[model samples]
Target: MPILDPLSFECVSHSDEQTQRLGARFAQAIPPVCVVALQGDLGAGKTHFARGIGMGWGAAQELRSPTFTMLQEHHREPDAGARLYHVDLYRAERAEDVASTGLLELLEDNDGVIVIEWPERAWDQLPPEALRVRFAVTAPSKRNLTFSTQSASAWQTLLKFRKLAFGV
Candidate 1:
């Protein structure tokens, strides 16, 4: 069980299609009841990556950063009943402010897949099983994405998933 191993990958993509490809891969990899924390600066493709997750979940509505909306719920294709919650905490002035949004309560209620943007704002709010995805811009449309897991077993599983995905 090497799920906790760290995995890294690089992709050269531009425009929304590139983002969709990355999202497709992630959508296939992620399972139900998974929590993903996306961290990156503005225009760092955090939302782009999340777009993929939403697609994977079969969400039909347009994918956009929930910066202003705070959180948006969408579903994958028809068969997949699991829902995807796109949550953006970019505007929260403080960690305490996050509670006002009721995002925590949402997580507790459904246990569905959650993709959180600006996750650092709620550092103490995430559960121990949450998966952390940190993004760094490598080039204009290129990104360096790293997947890390805090739990020992989770790290091994995630790394294994990455290896199976990248095949390197």
Candidate 2:
């Protein structure tokens, strides 16, 4: 792994809708070949956020949790060849378990975006450029989301997303 200049920002969502909207804004700013690592406990809105990413990315189908299946691929409209890969590593017990899911190949795929939930299951397998989002449930309907990244390009994308979503 390479040393990186980490950058991060935080935002609070008062509701699930707000979290999804924030995710949509981020989706608009993220690069096509990006990798996103989502970290949070169950009911932290990770799947909701990923659904918004799929919406913003023009996916033909809704993004859903792939906990059992482990991976779900959604094709984008207009660009039928473009895809959004949603990965859930919650069930994985080892880094090798994640490796067997073909995540390594997806990381090298430049024509699509990848969003991973429960990335802590395979942190060592993740690329250094991955943008990470940590979620915390603050209330029955509230959530705190922290976005961080070591990659400069992903940092720029997060800045753009923040400006667009928060006007700051």
Best by TM-score: 2
Residue lDDT tens for model 2, 6-86: 588888888888888888888898888888999999999999899889988889998989998999988987899887899
Each prediction's RMSD over C-alphas, in Å, is: 3.5, 3.8
lDDT of 1: 0.74
List TM-score per model, in order. Answer: 0.82, 0.92
Q: Clash pairs of candidate 2?
A: none
Worst 10-residue stretch by lDDT in candidate 2?
Answer: 1-10
Error of 1 at 161 (Å): 3.7
Residue 55 alpha-carbon offset, candidate 2, angstroms? 0.5
lDDT of 1 by residue, 53-116 (tens): 7765578786788888788888656645767888999998876678877788976785588899
TM value for model 1: 0.82
